[model samples]
Target: MKRVLFLFLLIGFISKAQVKPTIQKDDIVRIETTLASDKMEGRQIFTTGVDSASAFIEKEFSKVGLTYYKGLKNYRQEFVVRNASANNVIGILPGKSKPNEYVVFSSHYDHLGKEENGKDKVYNGANDDASGTTAVIALANYFKELNNNERTIIFVCFTGEEEGGFGSKFFSESINPDDVIAMFNIEMIGTESKWHKNSAYITGFEKSNFGTILQNNLKGSKFRFYEDPYLEENLFYRSDNATLAAYGVPAHTISTSKMDSEPNYHQLSDEVSTLDFDNMTEIIKAIAISSESIVNGKDTPTRVQKIR
Candidate 1:
């Protein structure tokens, strides 16, 4: 009788595992390579490259069965920055029960366009943000497949982040901050963290209990999320999450880049070849798993303190 019960449990576990949508390294590679390729021309804001990249993202969202946000005809959330046209590709997966409450996943898609000095003029920006954008796409596909989110999920690829975060600033003004439950702004996960393998850090870990909620969700997993090591840099307010965070939303940026020693940082050498696709795949998977509770409305992160 004991053996029968053990077998039944094992079968159930295997079935659940089979049904899970695993984020694959190949998917990461495909998305990152295309976005970081020379043809993209670095995806700089106000450049043809950025427009092409936004179009590509829109196609991917449609392919994944994501629809436009409410009252929008298409996925491109167009805006202007310094009189230059900019776009934020947005897709929505409405929740089953609580469609008004939102859990946002964002990544900046813009990068340095071209350098004048070097023969390799293109700044690929694979590690700076292409990796994060790839993760956003993969996460969208995963959630679409699972079809189990209880709170609305918003996937956004922002432009003009490198040019002073105009995209996010505009977006923040357009939304009601109270409806936003949490924001996961993924950035620079192409390489492993300085802490060790399968680890990443969240900026402004002390600003709220958001990191705690994430860590608690990841209990028993090998992946570890830690506090930002370079607190002195005030990294929490430096990224695209800052705008929403100012309005008291629990927004944070997740990354694994070693700011002090990262070789490729903003240079033209930051290409897809420089990234570790395996580590990136693991990071994306960890985010998807840890965010399950928030997406399902089982957990809500503490609000960040409103900045003056």
Candidate 2:
């Protein structure tokens, strides 16, 4: 009875800013191309290429007018691993009505580096995460333009995901998970999902009501969200969201990568040419629209069972 009442009220409070915030496919292309370019050396951690990626992300955050996270001087949140340095780029758009609550959007920027002597030396991870990282930037731009969120929105591009979830682990430890209302950890949305275009799946969908709330908010749109179908692969435990999920936060990954049949899963062939920018743009729009209630502090998702 309480659940039904909450849904009814949530549906009633649909965003007054019905005009979709601008999220251009062209902008996505520009960022994706730059990140996947051969010059970035596939953005491997501890490489000059990784440093370049971090700088690029910081520039985009600045362009979007995002303020620094937690009073940091810049977006580069530095941390070390095995005596080598890797940094996550984070930007913030503080909320007005509910400043204490937090909503996070994130993706990993690290990937496998180039082959030493191969003809196609670069492992351009366009679809693997450039697409996801692009979505993070695009979303940040969108929300900042809207400028009406009630819960603080954080945008972060994590490093060392390929090496293991090093960046996310460091970040999760730095923040109190209880303050984080929800986390949207995007990955691999460049290709068509198993459900095809205009659709994406959420990892750890059943762990909390996050997916349900998202789907409910998207009811009027053509886009749809499905549960992660590759249960045997244990995808929920993989990627950047795992650490926070263990902390009982409602953190989930959104993706369209088909586990068994992804042709470019980890190949050097994961270039920008393979992505469908139109479809990717729609997915970003869907997320922005669906998350309106949460961002504005109108909806609160249940916590994940804390992993001990």
Candidate 3:
């Protein structure tokens, strides 16, 4: 009887030690709402709205205990594109072993600021990219708490994606492409994919084995990551991932928006209410889990063929 009682106590202790994660649906909703609100003025580059968005991202990074990247005093990495000044908010969670290698999570925070002729002037980009930005924060917090990564994880929220991927283009020039193991660029995950339930898509899925690795990690799970359905649209080159992919980095964008049917794309009607927070949470969690092998340095995805 004493042995049985001790066994029960041991199980109880183990369960207690496994604390629940803080990245909940409510947290996602709150962050998305704030980032996509009218108060942000659509987060356009060179606008006050974009500045406010960057400041909020910095605060969120600080709250989650993510350290600023090396050679920087703060989270904001400011750069210039033509005459316009832009910043990418970056934070780092150093690895337990292979600190020199990097696995990056990126999302652009900028959107079309506002429209002149529309009756609804504010272009709140709730689904366009606020959802992606929220995932970056959520993943950062999740990884920080778990503390199990083997390769350094960099979380970056870029500013000039709306203006022809300028932010990522500038950022790609700053880092040595060889050190970057992979980049998962999250975009427009606020809605369900054309697959409609429990699935998302990856652009440029055939360029490398990146999607295969992610799907392999999610074996036996309901959540699925598939190839982009809108191949004819040439989505692979459209988003922030293109810059690094051009340099042979295994970078791709994950998204749930149906390109042909997504009604809210670049419209004034894209608000927080239109998003499905539960689905968003599931996608973010799946990203965290699917990235485990890469983060641990156990799986190295094949590099993309550099485009001329």
Residue 49 Cα positional deviation in candidate 1, in Å, after optimal superposition: 0.5
**Model 1 residue 32 CA deviation in Å:** 0.4
lDDT of 2 by residue, 1-308 (tens): 99999988887777543665699989999999999899899999999998999999999999999998885799999999989988999999999999989999999999998999978999999998999999999999999889899999999999999999899999998899999999999999999999999999999999999999999999988999999999999999898999999999999999999998999999999998899999999999999998999999999999999985
Selected candidate, larger lDDT, 1 vs 2: 2
User: What local distance difference test score does each model get?
Assistant: 0.92, 0.94, 0.93
lDDT, candidate 3, equals 0.93
CA shift of 90, model 1, Å: 0.2
Q: Could you list the CA RMSD of all candidates, in the order they appear?
A: 3.4, 7.9, 2.0
The window of 10 residues in a row where model 3 has the poorest summed lDDT is 15-24
Among all candidates shown, the one with the greatest TM-score: 3
Question: Candidate 2, residue 277: CA error in Å?
Answer: 1.0
Task: Give the per-residue Cα lDDT of candidate 3 at 123.
Answer: 88
Which digits, one per residue and each the tens of the lDDT, describe model 3 over residues 1-308?
99999999999999879664656999998899999988999999999999999999999999999998878999988888878788999999998999999999999999999977767888899998999999999999999988889999999998888888888887888788999999999999999999887899999999999999999999999999999999998989999999999999999999999999999999889999899888999999999999989998999999999984
Clashing pairs in 3: none
Cα lDDT tens digits for candidate 1, 9-31: 99999987748778988888999
Clashes of 2: 0
The residue-level lDDT of candidate 3 at 207 comes to 98
State which candidate, 1 or 3, has the greater TM-score: 3
How far is 237's C-alpha from truth in model 2 (Å)?
Answer: 0.9
